[model samples]
Target: MKKSLPAIAPGLPLGLLLGLSTAAPRAFAQEAAAPALEAAASLNAGDTAWMLTSTMLVILMVIPGLALFYGGLVRSKNMLSVLAQVFTIFALITVLWAIYGFSLTFGGTGLFYGGFDKLFLAGITPDTLSATLGTIPEYVFVAFQSTFAAITVALIVGAFAERMKFSAVMIFSVLWFTLSYIPMAHMVWGGGLLAEDGALDFAGGTVVHINAAVAGLVGAIMVGKRIGFGKEAMPPHSLTLTMVGASLLWVGWFGFNAGSAGAANGIAGLAFINTILATGAATVAWLVAEGLHKGKASMLGAASGAVAGLVTITPAAGLVGPMGSIAMGVIAGPLCLWGVSGLKRLLKADDVCDVFGIHGVGGILGAILTGVFCAASLGGVEPEGFSMAAQVWVQCKSVLITVVWCAVASFLCFKVADLLVGLRVSEEDERRGLDIAVHGERAYVS
Candidate 1:
């Protein structure tokens, strides 16, 4: 807990270098200089308070929310190892972001990445406001985005849990965050190639979910299969705990999607409602698919499907209409279920928690659908451009770039970490389980 707090609440001193103002909308003129907003989005007291709360909510998703979720899924003997990896990775990502990740992604610069104006948060102050959120201090904005960054790296643990070495996880966490995650965030959200071509990623479908997904698949392959893949049972140790954690993730995602709008307003409200509607629809679709695929529907399938829906809607939450969100939920559920149970088995990849199936697959689906449903006519927002053909092209390009980049970069990082500390534990350690071998602790005791 001590290690984690410093990362989320690092007391970056709020000196007088920067000032708080409203987040004014930057006007985008095709092939022209960026138009300065006449007035940035104002920082209302209500907005600031809500954002602060939402920011903390996202942070919670990593600390206890994700830790508990993944911990409960693995065997009791390996729980703390998974938990420690999640906890430690959160802290490491926080420090790196405080140091350089934020600047490289959000600092103003040319295509591909940004310049180093905000190194170590050099000029950030309590008063400095980012153009995106108006008057809230830029430091505050960075703090909120930090949670997203932390959780993305932590999620990779699911792919290689129960086998990976803790020290190796630490090394890859930093490298992937800098080389891969920062560049993708810059391109899709911070004003890179995707944004230049008018791609729509309200939060981080490409930046977070898809990037994590591809990296996860690579890790699963590199770490190789679990000790007894098809031969062993390998069932979730506690479905009850998994369900509880999934519930928290469901509730916490409201902050994840709505907060992306950057303030308390109509757009936030729309995102919140769509989050609920789409998640509900996906839950239904997923359970239905599971019933048809297997002899009976499983509780885990229902929860996992809801997550798939949430991932699919994340990128389009702000731009797409409500009905479009519902449609996305309906489609992504069955697709994700098929990917997890069918394709995963055929491929024989050991993605313990289906990270690529749900997050990566769902994110790609969401990115493309954002173009389809973002029509002013669909998602409650006034549509800017709803060319199915054009937006789909943009969506395809963005997903392709994110997948390829994340895969290649993550593969190299994983290999380097492996060669350094070794990615997986020894055969003796595997038999003993990672909870004891890697972390020297257990999740519970009699």
Candidate 2:
């Protein structure tokens, strides 16, 4: 004659009251558990290892990879200067990123910039997890993201190479990194405005390539052409070195594109394969375009094509399939060739290394095409409630925003650096070569 109840849902004399008193507290306790507990539950060794490896690869891309690539493109007099600029920029940004850069980039809940709550990594610890990748320690995420800031700033050096003062380069990079790179990182990757609007940047098309390209273009214009630029031949000092540097960049980009997935999962694998396919296709497409246009496919064209493909595939790596990535590469090759050649002539900026031509045009192209290829109909990872047209609009919006922000910020930063320390070397020093005049060393001992 006792009231019967389900075994799992024990019918207490006061069912609602007892449930609130006992079950509610337990649920609250679970929700309020410490980060250490969460880490124990979800810390993934495989993902952590992969991210660490990726971090190293990206660092390699900056030091020897970018350094040598830019170095080989300049006259021998400026070779060492290129190395010095790239190395110093990398070192400086790494320090700044540790100080307040990480905090202002990913700490706060703001539309444009992050808060300074994590200044000098204030409260972060070995057990702290990143908001985006909960499985990895927050420190790993900081290191990984910091490398991105370094490479992006380093990319600007190529535009004004052989003319700018080393001091000016240092000052400008600090200002731009603090102002431009940090804000863009926050907006796209740090849960800020662009992210809120559902803009996609898998590995930094808008953030890295496009942002740097715009900044470089501005710097090239503001700094003025190298001495005797129009009249001088300005041939690359060493194509052999350029080829070697390009090879390193190609190898290191696997980490750049694939590592963006934030996990050692299927998406990472997809990014990896797509990077390989897209780069190869771009190489072929570039050579074909050059062969038809110039009557020969040179090593420079091949190297340029490879980089174009890499840039085009960066933002869409994980979102699209291999074939889609190949399509992007094929399109980017010729377009970027024109960017460095015809468009370079039109812009009339020195662009010592074609930063605008390759990175700028390729990034805009890739970012837009990502919208097309990310549709499930094109063998992409399907987004929930996806519309191709809507997504393309969002992509274009992101690109436009990045272009405007970077252009203005770069122009301002260059002007500031010019005010602080002269932006250019003395004409005499420039003619003498930065290696001996500025740094008192030579790339070649001759």
Q: Write the per-residue lDDT of candidate 1 for residues 213-310, one digit (tens) a residue.
A: 89999999999999998897998888887788788888888888887766666667778999998999999999998888787888888879888998
User: How many residue-pair clashes does candidate 1 contain?
Assistant: 21
> In angstroms, how far off is 187's CA in candidate 1?
0.3
Query: For residues 380-399, what per-residue lDDT tens digits would candidate 2 score against the true structure?
Result: 76444557888888889989
The candidate that wins on lDDT is 2
TM-score of each: 0.91, 0.91
Q: Report how far off residue 65 is in candidate 2 (Å).
A: 0.4
When superposed on Cα atoms, how far off is each prediction in RMSD?
A: 7.3, 9.6
lDDT of candidate 2?
A: 0.83
